[model samples]
Every structure is written in C-alpha cells, then in structure tokens.
Target: MHAPPSPLEAERSDGGSGSVRIGVLVPLTRPGWVEAGHHLLAGIELAGREVNDTGGIAGRPLELVVRDTAADPRKAAAAVDELARLGVAALAGEYHSVVARAAAARADALGLPFLCSSAVLDALTEQPTEWVARLSPPQSRGWRVYADFLLGAGHSRIAVAAQPSIYWASGTRVVRDHLAPRGGTVIELDMNALTPAAVCDALVDHRATALLLLVGHPEPAVSIVKAVRRDQRLAEVMMGAPAGQPEFAAWATSLGDDGAGIPFLRYLPERLGPLGARVERALRERLAGAPSFVAFEGYDTITVLADVLRSHGTDRARTAESWPRVAVQGSRGRIEFSRTPGISVWQWTGTPVHVVDRDPAEPGRFRILHAG
Candidate 1:
C-alpha cells in the first residue's frame, strides 16, 4: 500500500528517450501470496492499460518484468537481486513481511528504492533506510479497534489467541496494551500447534468473553472455529484477520451456525472512487468470483507503485521527495504506507472482523456479526 516500496526498486531512465522497466517479485507459488501476486499482476496490467491509453512513462511504453519467489525469503531476496541485475527502473514485491523484508534489505543495500505491497512489521521501518515504506497499518491499529469494540460492547475480560511468530506476536502486544487501561486483561496463548478443542480449552481456561485470532493463514483458524462450534460454546463471539482470506469461508462451510457472524478485516471498500472502480472491475474480471484478500492486496500494491511513477518519484532523488506525498486510491481503501514491520494491515489497524459462516449449499454468505 505504500506508494514507494523502499524494499522493492530504484529506477534509472533508459538511454532511449521514452521507456522504463519495472521489476515485480511475486509470491507466485505460495497459496496465499500466490493469490496476492495474481491479483497484483492483474492490477498492474490494468494500470498499464491506463498508461498506454494516454502516453507512457516519459513517452516510452512501460515494461513490467516479473519474478516468482514462491514465498521463500531467500528465494525472494535472490529474485529481487536478479531483477535489479536485469536492470529495472523501479520495483515492487509480495505482501509477506519476512519475505518483503529480505527483499527490501537487499534493495536498500543496492540503493534500490523498493516498493513493498503490504508488509507492516516494525522492523521493516526500523533501519530507516528511506527505501522501504508500507501501506498497511500495524497490529496496534487492529487491537485499538478490537479493544474499543470490546469496551463498547461491555466485555470486561478478553483473551487473544495468536501465534508466537513475530507478526502475530506484534498483534498480541497491541491487543494487550489497548486492553490494559480498561478493566480488561488479555491472556496470551502461545501454542506450537493446536486443534480446535485445544483452542477451546485455552479459551475456557482463560475464561475469556471474546477472542482475537491474529494469524497469517486460515487453516489453523478454521480448526479453532470448528472446535469452538462443535463444543457449542454459546457465550463467546469470534473476530479474526483477513489473513484467513475469503477462501477460508469455503473451507469451513461445514461450521454452519458457529461460523456464522465471523468478522473479516477487508481492505477494499464496496464503493471505489473513479480509479478505484476501474481497478475493482479489472480485479473482478480477473478473479471471476473469488473474494480473497489477495485480490485487494494485489490491486492496491500495483496501483500504489504505478501512482508513484505518475504522481510522485520515478528517480531516487525524486522518489525520496515524492514518496511522502504520494497516495493511491484503489480497490484497497486509500492504499498507502505505515511505519510497521509486516506486509499486512490487520495486524495493526484492527480488522472489521466478519464471521466466516457461509453455507456451501447456498450461494450467499453469513452476515457480518459486528463491523469492528
């Protein structure tokens, strides 16, 4: 979401008068990042359409050079270097914070002003390279929303179940800080691997009235939900991150009523403005009907980078100047950057938390239980 990804690319005007080559490192193999990459490419192509229709960057057609990292940090780092070796004027990369960080560090070392799609981990911004920027808010943002929502809803005690991984760990910290001032105490459950029942047991042991599931994938989350629902824990409500992706609903269709009213933190708003509309339409055409987080992330990442070229910096000196000023309106509501550590926003600025209960037999989905 950040307009200029310090972790992504730096540009050099081609000797020829009118062309620029941009490099993109995609999470082409991993299921989540792969979906993210596809939508991102689709978003770029759509932007490419607009640029071609007018003129091109500096008058020459813009060329997009892409590579697949398969979600591996080392591979992503290598791919970024390779793209730089091949000589791209600008660059953009995947949404995973760890992978994006590796890529960003390399870009910074090379003096490449890399653009990251959505990683928001605080470490990414810690070194202050000025080359990297993120568009997503941090876990603090999400925790703020959830804590406010919880206090407003009148829940006195809450427990958050999150992975010990750096990304989720950050989210947990945010949740705790927000809940402390109020009469609420957030118990952290660190688990190597857990089944649905184990999750329920943790929640039960803590005697939590609510649970915030902060994770980057949907499978473990799906398992947790099943156990909760199977046991019929009627007192608790569940909220989670968009990291579960829309596909999570498909996989957990069996949860029926329990999955009903799960909240998902979505990036794209329903009504996209002019530019946002075009990106949305292109994404729908490309995605068919898959309402995954990848589509929004992809659209936002590419659009932000393209906007940086058009409205902000194309050269490093200009980039440093323009990055702070650039903002892109796309499928993701006002895609931009945040000073965080991961390529994700839900970990920071809290998600809207949608319930995931969608009936497989029916085409529609379970309604939103709560907005925040």
Candidate 2:
C-alpha cells in the first residue's frame, strides 16, 4: 500500500470563497486519531456550510484551509506558522492536547487568534496570552469529575495503565492528586514496560478495583481490556477510560461487549437544546453515525469564529480581541469565554462534562452514569 500523504501533500480547502480564510488543524492520518479527525472536520464543514447558507460572514464567504497535524507537536506548530503566513484570519481545530499546546504557543507568538476545538490539556500555553482560546473543558475539570465518580462508585484503590506522554502524565497527576485528598489511592501501571498480561498481573497485585486505560486506542488499550476481561481475577475489577477511548464506534467494533460498561468522560450536556438537537441530526447524517462530543466542539468552534468574524471583521487582532465579548449559542450550550483560574487561555466554562459508558447489554447505546 502507498504511504499516507504527508501533511503538506494532504492540505486542502473546504467550504466558502477564498476571500476570508480560517486555518483548520486536525490529525487526519495515523499516529493521529484519524476517526476523531473525520468527525471533527465534519462538524466544522457543516457549520461552515450553514454560515455560507445564511449569508457567508457579511457576504465574504468564510473559507477553511485545512492541514493534517498527524498528532505531531512540531507539525502542528509548523502548520500554525504556515497558516499565519497564508493570511488566515484565524486558526482552529486540533484533537491532540500536546499538538494543540504547540500550535497555541506558536499562534500566541505570531498573534493569530486560535479557537482550539477539542484538546483539553489545562495548560495549552506556557503563559497567558489573548491570542488563544479553548472550547473544551480543561483536563483538570473533567478528570477530577472522573475521580469523583470513582470514589462514589466505591473504588478507592485505582490503577491506571498509562503510556508515556505529557497528556497522559497530566491526566495521571489529576487523578492521583484529586483522589489522594479524598481517601482514594492511585496505582500506576506503566504501559511502556508492561505487556497486556503484565498489566493484568499489576492490577491483581495492587488489589485495584478499577483499571483506567490511559494509553492509546486499539493497541495496548484494546489488548489490556481483553486480557483483563478474560482474567478471572479481574472479573470483579472495573475498567475505565476517562480520556474517552471508547467514545468512537471503532472501540465497539474492536472490543464489542468487552468494551461496554467502561466509564469515560465526555463534554456534552445530559440533554441537547434545540440548537444542539438540530446540529446532532445534521452531524449524524454527515458522519453516518452518532457524533462524538469532539464533533460538536468542532462545529461550535466554527460557530463562535463565524460570530466573531461577522462582528469583528477578518482582522486577526480584532478576532483575538473579541474572545471576552463572545456569547453565541453552540451545539452544546450558550458558548462564552472568561479567564478561569489555573487555565492559560480564554475558556468556555459552561461546556458540560459527563461520565458515560456503553451499556453492557447494548454496546451501541451510551448510558450516562454521572454528570459534572
């Protein structure tokens, strides 16, 4: 088979006239989560189409210049630079947190307004800057809620099967820190040095009631689930994935019944409002499946950016300046930005956080276990 297209070779434009351009960064190839990227792009494209249908940002059609980051921080940073030079009015979209952080830093240095779609790392930038804002709830907020769920479920001794990365490391710290103060204990199972079977052994040795899959999808995550599920000792052990590995259909297709009942964090309201419902139906048709929260985030990124471009014009500085003034109805809820403590960028504090899992009897359907 031919090698996947390079980031530059894969770049393309989607929707609207070329008069006004928005840079779209997504992980559309391997090493990146291609499935998540597709869902994200669908939402962005749908919103862009709708914006054009409604009059196209003050009659100047909003164009999207897309680039594939391939889950690489360096690639994403370079894409930000190239998009900035291309005269894009702003930058948007990135699923991986580390990649988003790199892109955010570059955008800030260059003064390009970036509305990050789905990377939830608490620190998207090393220092505060007005040029970057985020649509997803920070990792600390979501993962802390997840830790609370673990406590409520009576799991005090928890184990995390984690891969080495800044994102995974931060998540581990969040779970550990949040749990330690509340009579909960966390055990770490390093995936770098352990096999699936070894992970099962570690879980049993630690007497961990819950095993959180903090690794990548379909490789160690899938293998660990299988190994643990088959091990009689782990039968009573609960499995969780707060980073949302099982949110996509592939997780079901790969693990099926084995994948069900593993709780994960998602940033969606318990119920969709009128705008959310309308967008859901459209996104469903576009994706040919239920859209993940990431997709809604992508759609909302465009929705907010479109609003800013319309009111603030296409000037980069003007777009960055309008973050605090934003109050648009997104697919999830009323989108607004503010300076949240410990977070470096303009944050939408209202993005809903939910703990959900696939039903054991019906792997295709999700059951909301807890909300935060």
Candidate 3:
C-alpha cells in the first residue's frame, strides 16, 4: 500500500489551501459522458461519504460544487471561472479534451490547483501553468503503450485509423516512433477523409499485421467494425486504446463472436490499485444492465478526487498538495501523474488486459491476453 504523506509534507500549497472545495465540470449530455460522469460522481460521493463517515476532512465537511460544461469549450471556461469565483480549494475535471483547455485556463488564472481526470490528448497539458496537473496518461503515452504491445506481440506491420479530431493529431508522431526502432511500418487513415466503407476498403489494401485505431467516438468505432464486416475481415484486425466508450457496446451485436474478439489497450482494470474493485463494484452494482470503459473511468476519476479531499485535512492548501499523491486503483491498475512534460504513466503495471471477442458464439467472450 502507498503511504500517505506526513502533515508537514502535506502542507505544500499549490493554491491557498483552506476548506476542501471541489468544482467538477463535465459534459452532462455527451451521450456516454453522463453515465460515465455519474460513476465519477459516485466515486466522489463514496470518498466524501467515507470522509464524512469518518468525521469530515479536518473536522469540516467537504463541499462539492458541480457544473455542466455540456461538452462545450466556452461553457467549460465559464464554469471553471464560476467555480473559481465560488472559491473552490481545488478543481477536478472537464471530460472532453477541448473543453478542458478552457477550464484549465480559468484554474490557472485563479492560481488554483487543478487536476484533470480524463483529457488524454497530448496538447491538454502541453503548456502547464502553476494550476494544472493531469491525472490521465498523456496521448503520447497511449501511443507508446500501443507500440510496445504490438511490437512485443511480434507484429511487424501496423495500420492506423484515427478519429477525425484534434486530440489524435497531437500524438500521431508516436506511431512512427513506436514503429521506428523495430522496423515495423505504420499506415495512416483519416476518419474525415473516408467513410466507414472507404476505411474498410483501405484496411483491406494495407494487409498489415495489426490495426492501431485511435477512435474516440463510439459511432465511428461501431461503423468501422460494420464497414470491415463487408469483407469479412474481423479476425484480420485489432484495436488499441480509446475504445472504452459506451458506444462500442453496439458493435457487439454486429460483430457477434468477432466483436468480443477485439483487443484493447487502455487504462483501468484491477491493477491500478483500489480502482479495479471500485469500478467493478460500481459497474456491476449501479450499471448492472450496462458495460463500458468510460463507466469505470468516470468512477475511478471521482473516487481519486474524493480521496484527495480526505488527504489534506480538507483544507485548500493541503488539498492542493494532495493532488500529487492522490492515486486511484483504476480498472487498469494504479494511475498517477508526473510533473514532467510529455511524460505520464500508461503501463498497466499489475492489471489485466481484456480483448472483446466480437464473436458472441465464442465461450471466451473476453480473455486476459496479458496479466500484470
């Protein structure tokens, strides 16, 4: 178990730490975002409940302030500003990477210590201010992890299909980096330039050993699977990270046994530490009728935030200092942040990797291809 910091050590102030106040900003209507957000909130609630159950942080109950960004960047900035004016000790979240930029800016202006839970895009934290720290692994890290997994799997050729979004552009270079040293080749495709049918056509021509998909939205991910089906090449391809959204659930029907066969490289699972149990229990209990990567991620993100509150005596200064130590055992294993630029932990450490086999008729609906 990781040890908590001592009082003197915990006194470091990134922002004036007083009563622990957290302002949460998320897009409440981004289809899968809300359900995922609920889990995150649940995690926060659970942590708060524990602290209050134990007698509040520093003898004061934590005040959780929330606002909906509606997945809009302008609204996100405004929401953070509103939260800052309300004088939150620290700020946590804005789900979309684009929205996070605005919220993060507001936090910086206030000199408030802010930690972003998701927003894995590289540019999200590129130019750090005194107020920001990202809890999610950077986009660059995600790609490198992909490279490692594929290269280690003995695949020498890979093809890339990325969602047409700014987030994916930031780490596009990592694909080459991962392939560089190993003599593997990477082929790239743009979602905007090609329809699912077009994408499927391109994949057929590549004939690469594996597929490196950086799709963020579920609709496209599902479409890609369907598009590929025309050629009946489900087994010929694989997937990496950014495949955890609730939208992927629809693909299970079309791919059937093949859908369950998709490989995943992502964060959260039992290895991240306390998060695995946290997510499994939350997903199984509250979201019993559902399955999603975002559900687990959202839950773990809020759970970590709540724990941060309890760590620093519920005081703002302590809360700010506690950001660095706040760790969540996500579905993938323990997730933490680095103060360094272009560096974040993405390895599963001691977690399990689950690949969804699209083939429903298969007994191995999911398998642990790698166990940390």
Candidate 4:
C-alpha cells in the first residue's frame, strides 16, 4: 500500500524549468518485458524530442516524468496517484493491458486525462470514465478482425493455444465467440497443461487446419512453433496469434525457421506515408533497431497528448473535457475519440488492424498479408 516508485530521472531537453511534464507509464524492468519497455520508452522520447524541436506545445517544452510499473497492476494504480501528485498535465504510455486497466481506474478516480499507448484488453475501454482514452483498438474489436481473417482464409477447424493471462483469455474468448457460430470448429489447448508434443497430437487428432495462439509470452509460443515445425504432417497447417504482433522479434529470434510463415495481427501498416515514414526512420535510428508497432503507439500517444496540452494548456480537467472533440493527425491516421458503447470512455474508434506474416523466403521479414 505504498505508492508506486517515481522515475529516477525526468527525461527532457535543456531549459525544462518551464517545460510541460506528462506522466509516462511503462514496464521498464518487468519480468519478461525489459526489451519491450525499452522500445516503448524510445518511441515516447522520440516524440518528445520532435515536439520540442518544433517549438513544443504552446511554446513550452515537453518533459516526461516516467514511472515503471514493473508489469504490476497495483503498482500501476499507485503510479497514477504519484503522477497526478506531481501535477502532470496528462498521462500517456503503457504496454501491458493489466497495468493499463489499473492506471485507467486511477485516472478515472483522479479525473485526470490518460491515453493508453498499446494495451488492448476490451474491457479497458468498457469502463465508465470520461478521462481514459486509448491509442490502440480494444481486443473486442481486434480479435473479431483476426477471426474474420482466419475464416475468410478458409480455415475451418482451428485450435487455440492459450496461456492463463487475461490478455490471452480475452483473445481466445473472442475467436471462439466469433468463429464458432460461423461453422468453424475451435479446440483449446492450455499451454501449461499441454506439452509441445501433446499440442501437436491434438492438432493431428482434430485435423485442425490452423492454430490460433493466445499466449503473449514468446517462450511458450516459441516452444509450440518449434515442435510443430519438426512434424511433417503439421508443416502445411497455418499458425497465427494476436499476441505475437508486439513481441514478434523476440519470438522470431528464438524460433528461427519455425517463426517464418507465422501470421499475427499488427496495429499499424508496414509501409508509411511521408510523415509516418519520417517518424519511423527517426525511431529506427534512435532505437538502433527496427521500429515496433508499440513504437508507433508510443509516438502517436505523445503526439496526441502534445496537441491536447497545446490547445488546452496544462489544466487536466479542460484536457479531459476537450478529449472528445480533439482530432489530431497521428503517424497511422487521425487520432480521435468518442463515447462509443462496448469501448472505453473516449476511446478511439476505427483503429486499423493488419495481418503480417513472417516471410518464409526471407527470414525475419514480415510481409503484409491483409489490411483492414
């Protein structure tokens, strides 16, 4: 019941004395997510630098009071309190849905504006609050997109490999809910209960044409992929995952050849327009690696936050009040929100979903298979 620990350092340019500070929440040293946190932090920092270089918001520079949630929900909620206490104009940046849920609750209670960068649990947006907004589409909508894509690809008998996390659970539930009634058969496999060999057995037994993975962590998914790739019978069977999109590099690096030809849902396009291309290049140069979907999420989240702070000044209430109407152009598309049912309060609607498949011809390269 102690408050979440504050960031050791505030990231900003020189002359931050008059800068506008915003709370940036990310899992910096969380178990199994250190690399992801670095990617997110890089994106947010890139956005902050861009805004400052362009004269900042209302002629004042932007600074981030970053807080590490360590992938803990309680800590995330406490971080919200600490951020609000620090007098930030708004809150932004998140990678874990569980943390996002807790942070959303705290933001609602404090009447502060919070923009989720990349957490996609459907219920995060379903909460009754006016201050919470998300840059990513909720899983309720995104999963359906996955389901439709699978069914349209002529995949009828599908097997789902799932972990026990709520994020994975939500994904399995949506695929089952959407695909079952469409004459598609779904078989669920618990990642903990089933060995890679046992999962392969089930796929062969069920004659499943495709496997839908709900496990978020890369190691489990990697094990399953490695096992299936060695089986000749399962070689032709398609494998897809909603959770794979964000941590694809980790999975690919581990699974190697097994990772190729696997399909996953991504939030942004592989290709970009002029503005997006510039941002993507900047992020790649800054991170010294390929840009992730969450990087775009981080960049877009802060860009929208800068716009809100610029127009509404540093008043949290006015920023929350103005959230519903503010339409800022993001790296992907126009970032806007409305009070839509079955979504979080002030959640952005019509967030695009794209299916990218790891190329078999060229390892580690993802080719856009479908766009929606």
Off by over 4 Å in 1: 1-19, 216-218, 242-258, 290-294, 310-314, 327-372
Q: For all the candidates, what are their Cα RMSDs to the real structure? A: 5.9, 3.0, 7.5, 2.7
Model 4 residue 38 CA deviation (Å) reads: 1.8
Q: Return the TM-score for each candidate structure.
A: 0.78, 0.96, 0.76, 0.93
Residue 179 miss distance in model 2 (angstroms): 0.8
- Judge candidate 2 at residue 58 and give its lDDT: 89
> What value does the lDDT take at residue 346 in candidate 2?
99
- Report the alpha-carbon TM-score of model 1 versus the true structure: 0.78
Task: Tell me the whole-model lDDT of each prediction, alpha carbons only.
Answer: 0.58, 0.91, 0.58, 0.80
Q: For residues 45-157, could you state the per-residue lDDT of candidate 2 as single tens digits?
A: 88988887798878877777888999999988888898898888999999999999999999999999999999999999999999999999999999999999999999999
Better of 1 and 4 by TM-score: 4
Tens digit per residue, CA lDDT, model 1, 182-214: 777877765566655777887777777776666
Please write out the lDDT profile of model 3 over residues 54-102, one tens digit for every residue: 6555565555666777667777777777777877767776667777777
Residue lDDT tens for model 4, 252-349:
67777777887878888656778789988998898787878888889898889888888878888888888788899888888788876777667888
Better of 1 and 3 by TM-score: 1
Which runs in model 4 stand beyond 4 Å of their true positions?
1-17, 245-247
Q: Give the TM-score of candidate 3.
A: 0.76
Sorting all predicted structures by TM-score, with the top scorer first, yields 2, 4, 1, 3
Best candidate (score: lDDT): 2
